[model samples]
Target: DIALAFPNQPRAAVGEVVTKAVERSAPTAQCTAVEVWLLAGGVLGMAEEVGAETKDEGPAKKKQKTTTDMTSARLRHIMLKFQDGAPKTPDGKKVRSKAEAETLMRKIMRDLNEEAKELKSKHRGRKPEDYALKSERFTKLCKEHSECPSAQKGGAMCGDLGWVSKDMQSKRGGNFRELVAALRPGDYSDIVTSMEGLHLLQRIA
Candidate 1:
């Protein structure tokens, strides 16, 4: 409205595509609405003032309902175990500090993303080998930089713990399942620390 009010102004150039993420709910589906803050009385007599305090507080409870969302997930990780008495791989990476571990993990991530982009450009469609190629790339990175023995098989692709469940526990002892719960498929967490040292975990499946 401000820009339209001054039609002759040179500052009226606004051309951009913006994408917004909204909650998946009835209002989002049919109402196709977005909420905004209002002034004390009105904005140029646009409408009466409205705020979250006066909005319907009904569905807020529905969000807390329990579910049988227990499902198995697949994950691949590049572990950078610091030499601070954390669990060691067969060939312990002599990372001496959290900073060192994070640096290595970020390097691996950089390499992984570059290769992934190249692969997508090369096979730019829904090909049969899409998942295989992507996961294989992650596997290769796992093989290269990961301190875990799973790196031996390209980030534990064939390891016994293939599709892990929410209730499952790690033999090395950590809230591994909790970590899994924090991610959706194709999402990776920031550097997480436990007795297992610094981790860069991604849920591929």
Candidate 2:
């Protein structure tokens, strides 16, 4: 979340380091320890500089006045549950173990990068109007399948599925088209293969 929050700076670097720290802490250590460390690091890094001319306010006021701006607020909101370390589902089942959680994180990060790559390709060519999975046939297939998650989400695959080409205007040939063409309804493509899963596609009308 911190990496997503600050894509281009020391925060991203620290976030990467902290992610490794969390991984090492698993099994015997709690993820909260990493969260606390990250929070403290962010606070220290974001602290306002104290100068001799601005020494009018007392230390209490200064501490109280240390503010987080919009980006920090968004980061905090997104990471609100990080300290809790992945909550259980509504049915009270544990979402994933610490190791599983780490794996999920890596998978998601890889997928995000793939999606960005496809988008970058689209930016260079003719951009297609973004389409979503809303076809009735697709919905019904998912609804009837107990194994598919889309069945629980009203038969629609999770958002994040979209088409992006290397050349937006010219759909000559690229990874995105090949990817969408490979879908077979309910089955998702290879993990982290495309912007979305490889086969998790629906006909966008």
Candidate 3:
């Protein structure tokens, strides 16, 4: 069993996606169960406080819950771990040992981090001239193809996402948030892929 935390609202949807991805990547027989823990009031400490406070408030008011209070609860994080037998390859062969599994997970995370770094480097290099040229092209594209499908379909359009916060940018798919955050206002990003599709984001303060 793997325990993950999710917002109560989208628990089902997030759980379904996570379960499917894990099952697809590892042998299903070895993976018996996937569980989600709905983290209320941010973190563990906060959750305890909410529970204690609610209990003290008595049963009458508890039944009359408000939407604002419910929506105010947000998921903090999801922790994933292997359960039962070790993960198996697509060919039905199990991973040899715990050490091996951990090693594999570490390597995968490392590679992902490295890829994010490389993407940032490609876009945010030291040379000023190259950066300016890239920004110019990005601006031109935004003007000429404001309604381009690639730019508009999934999330925000290609250019000027408008002073994106670090947290928001990092949440974008493909781990390109580091690249986005590193960019100064008016700096153009190289082509980046996230769940929202391809983006050529330019920071506009």
Candidate 4:
């Protein structure tokens, strides 16, 4: 998050090499990713089609080309973090052990699964849109379980993650953007284990 806010610049390190320091103002490790961009340029492996505007060729031989139009999505998530030697949460508190964090994440997932089954049976003959599992259930659980600061807003509508380009996400870790892309709209992801924490992702779009 800090890296996104302060992109294209060198960042300070957070520590007490001098000793007796509390090591406040954690420096972002992500700042080094600029070096990768300087080398590979972007999301190296795949090609993303950027639509080009139609143009006229000769006089009456005007031609047109249309690439696939890109679209965006809305997403929300619940995260359970442990004190893994990383920094504290946005609220400036440390989490418990990893085992405890995983336990809580599983419990939340189980509850969500139950809700999905119930909703399925109850609305069998109705339109999918009317009964599809979506944000509300997850939002309720998120407030109670997620440690992410966005929890206060129930993960917020757009996740407050803003626009992330393929190039940007390539340098970022946690495989978060990839996992999120796999989910269907209105569907929640399985428990995701990453360096940051365990998470449940819900695609609102």
Candidate 5:
């Protein structure tokens, strides 16, 4: 149950994707498709002083009907007691903020670099443990934003990480860092290193 708003793509392309989504819906779940701004109108009309005048304009272009569907997924509970600040771990320890998280990530990266150098010196193979550490540190932001206890901590509120420039814009997938960049800042994403496979990611904002 999702209403994905696609910008900059042709309406036909979106409609095709929606049709696929609807067809793939579970038996118990219903789905609908809509084409946005699908309308027809003639050229701009002009009025006459005598009465009403109609100018002979060319054929009317179809209106752009932005289609959106409604589904059953909705939040119902409204908790009056809300707390601010970063969430705590399961042991009730304070978690790190975004800035702190980034700093810690950099430290982790540095440590990993040193560890990789050591491993290369000791043996001529890559370190699985080091790769795991890198993925874990990179994905920490996503996890905290997902299951963290803090109320105000979640969401894509991260202002900027200088990931994307103004010129580049597309929804294509890339490496772990690029995936995070594709989203608005503070959106949760994961970095999973496998032999070679798609990375597991979850949006928390």
Candidate 6:
């Protein structure tokens, strides 16, 4: 486990160090997993700053303030992705253009929403086993179509991300975090653009 001080260092840098530490320790310690705990607000503090600034604004500014507020709310979500079909970008990097990524993500969200409705209808009042089966099916669907960064992990499709506090910075990025925070539990969000790609998120609690 790694205990990281809040407002201490960039998350990406910390993650790199953790990855290297694990790799180095693997030879003798056989490290399998690592956990990180943040000590302070870190990026979450930035969100507070935005909120403070909005407090004295006029009505027009209030509208803009609402946007900022939405961006910093806390949330937990299941994130799925739809990768750009193209194999490479103009720079020869293996990434999709923003437009292409958004289009694909929207399509995937539509499909997932329909499936969610069906699952709810079929299992809403059923036995625990029935609900478990529905959950399994949803997991399978996430695994089959998701292109999320963590999707490569076996049996990790649409995996729960746990509770994210408002203004927190996650591996999913700030925009993604804010998007999730804005949604109600059990709600499906529209396409969210992130550095990793485009995402279709479901807030599950």
Best by lDDT: 4
RMSD of each: 17.6, 18.0, 16.8, 15.6, 22.8, 17.8
What TM value does model 4 have? 0.50
**Weakest lDDT window of 10 consecutive positions for candidate 6:** 1-10
* Pairs in clash, predicted candidate 2: 121-166, 125-167, 125-168, 125-169, 126-168, 126-169, 127-168, 189-198, 189-199
TM-scores of all candidate predictions against the true structure = 0.48, 0.26, 0.27, 0.50, 0.22, 0.45
- Candidate 5, residue 36: the lDDT equals 54
Candidate 6's TM-score reads 0.45
Model 6, residue 111: C-alpha shift (Å): 1.4
Evaluated at residue 201, the lDDT of candidate 2 is: 27
**What residue runs in model 1 are displaced by over 4 Å at the alpha carbon?**
1-70, 84-95, 123-137, 154-160, 169-179
Q: Of models 5 and 6, which has the larger TM-score? A: 6
In order of lDDT, best first, we have 4, 1, 6, 3, 2, 5
Residue 11 of candidate 3: its Cα lDDT? 27
Candidate 6 global lDDT: 0.44
Q: List the residue pairs that clash in candidate 6.
A: none
Global lDDT for candidate 2? 0.32
For residues 1-205, write the lDDT of model 2, one tens digit per residue.
5443322223233545566777677667755323221111111122223321345753543332222221110000000011126677899977544344334434443343344334435444422223122233334433442233334553344332234332431242224344333322221222112222222222231
TM-score, cand. 3 vs. native: 0.27
Please, what are the lDDT tens digits per residue for candidate 4 over residues 8-84?
Answer: 11111011111113233255322222221111101110111122233553243322221112244455677887775
Residue 132 Cα positional deviation in candidate 3, in Å, after optimal superposition: 8.2
User: Which parts of model 4 have CA positions greater than 4 angstroms off?
Assistant: 1-72, 85-94, 125-136, 154-172
Model 3: lDDT of residue 188: 32
- How much is the lDDT of residue 25 in candidate 5? 84
